[model samples]
Target: MNRVVVLTDSRYLGQRMPGALIEALRARDMPAVSARADRLVAEVRAEEGTAPEPVWGMRRALPALRPGDLVVPRTRNAFALSLLAQAQLRGVRTVNRWEAVQAVRDKPYAVLLLARAGVPTPRTFLADRPGALAGLPGAVWPLLLKPPYGDNGHGIVRVDSPRELERLPWSEGMVLAQQYVDVAGVDVKLYGAGERVWAVRRPSPLLAPAEEWPEPVPLPVTRELRTLALACRDVFGLDLYGVDVLPSPDGPLVVDVNDFPNYTGIAEAPDVVADLVESRLTEVVHP
Candidate 1:
């Protein structure tokens, strides 16, 4: 029998998501294990006439993985990517694949990919220097400054003027400047796995007052949001992910694409994801 291993940080070992997934897999009589990416040790071996081969040394012993073993990466850290890449090298199957994760990790690149594929996304500009902000179309006030690689609303700021942009303790890494969409304190979160999708409307953290934050209300997945979400999955080649859309008079503008986001409001997500993993394993092992 092939093994199912979840690669993630040790902190998530007892978290709800990975724990739920592990339960689901075990319920189906499939073997499952949780491995921490931070505990991995690898080395490259080269000889006089042979190509270098990479070998992984686990801090804690794990069941030996075979070619058909399923490796599910559950974290966004760079270490997860490295581990997944090594798994690919050893012919292990991965959920969502490593290349897709690499592309979605860069916020600016993900937005550009969505726009190029005709997915409705906000107007975004990649600014390498402070002066690049001035070249944006309309160069209007209240622009959003975001780190090219960030998540969960961290390191994001709203700048009302060019002076504010100039004074931002700019760093060498690329920054993304986006036109802020007015959502009236409400935005839609859509989570997708394969063809299944679920949605919820929540108060926008940026616009909602802390004292008056509204509860997330479950929403019927609209055709527009469904179409947009599926397009994002196809464009990004993601088997499971989430999309944040801001409702606008112009239509739903996608503001963010998350890689394996927290399925907060989606009740059936864990089981569905488990099913997908099992299906993939069966296909690879049988084919």
Candidate 2:
């Protein structure tokens, strides 16, 4: 029998997504397991007469996964990437394949991909040193400085002038400096799972007040947003993910692409993802 497994962070143990997926899969009589990404270990080995094999374990205890089993890595951490890559190497099916996940993790690379695909994205540059800021051409005053890899809006800074950029605590690695696109205090988040897309509009966290934060309201899935979301999914080779877009005077600009984001207000997201997972698994077993 084929099995469905979800690898995620321990902190998300009680979150809606993979938990909902587990329940849905079980309801369909499929064996499902939710394992913590941090607790999993991946080992790669090569033998003389055969291809390399990937071995997976939890707390040093090896778990047997069949050829047709499905492994979904919900965490974007290094360990999860390693585990997902090794599993795919061993012929297991995965959502948002490791290569795609790794590519999207780098904010600059993700933006480059979007631009190359003719998708609307913010003007971005990689700043290796503080002096690079002075050379940016056509740069609007209020710029956004973001660490290549961040979550929950952490490691992101807004600077209105060169003086503010100079005062930043210089770090070793390069940071992504992007032109801030004004959205009139609102941002749209589009969640994509398979062929389904869900959208919501909320006050931009960057501009919203701490105590008066407005709740996200469901927005109609317009053609433009749907097209952009689907294009992003195909370009990133993602099975499920979220895209953040900001409205501009000209059009919408994609600001961020996230893998397996928290489906905060999307009630049907888990079910949609579960259906896709089952469909993939069935294809693998039947083909």
Question: TM-score of every model?
Answer: 0.89, 0.90
lDDT of 2: 0.78
Deviation in Å, model 1, residue 111 alpha carbon: 1.7
Best by TM-score: 2
**Per-residue lDDT for 169 in model 2?**
84
In model 1, residue pairs whose N, Cα or C atoms come closer than 3 Å (at least 3 residues apart or on different chains), thus clashing, are none
lDDT of 1: 0.79
**Tens digits of per-residue lDDT for model 1, 157-263:** 88777767667775647788778877877898999988999898988867644336555688999898899899999988998898888889999988888777667
Candidate 2 stretches with Cα past 4 Å from truth are 47-62, 137-139, 207-215, 285-287
Steric clash count of candidate 1: 0
Tell me the deviation in Å of residue 165 in model 2. 1.8
Model 2, residue 73: C-alpha shift (Å): 1.1
Model 2 reaches what TM-score against the true structure?
Answer: 0.90
lDDT of all the models against the reference?
Answer: 0.79, 0.78
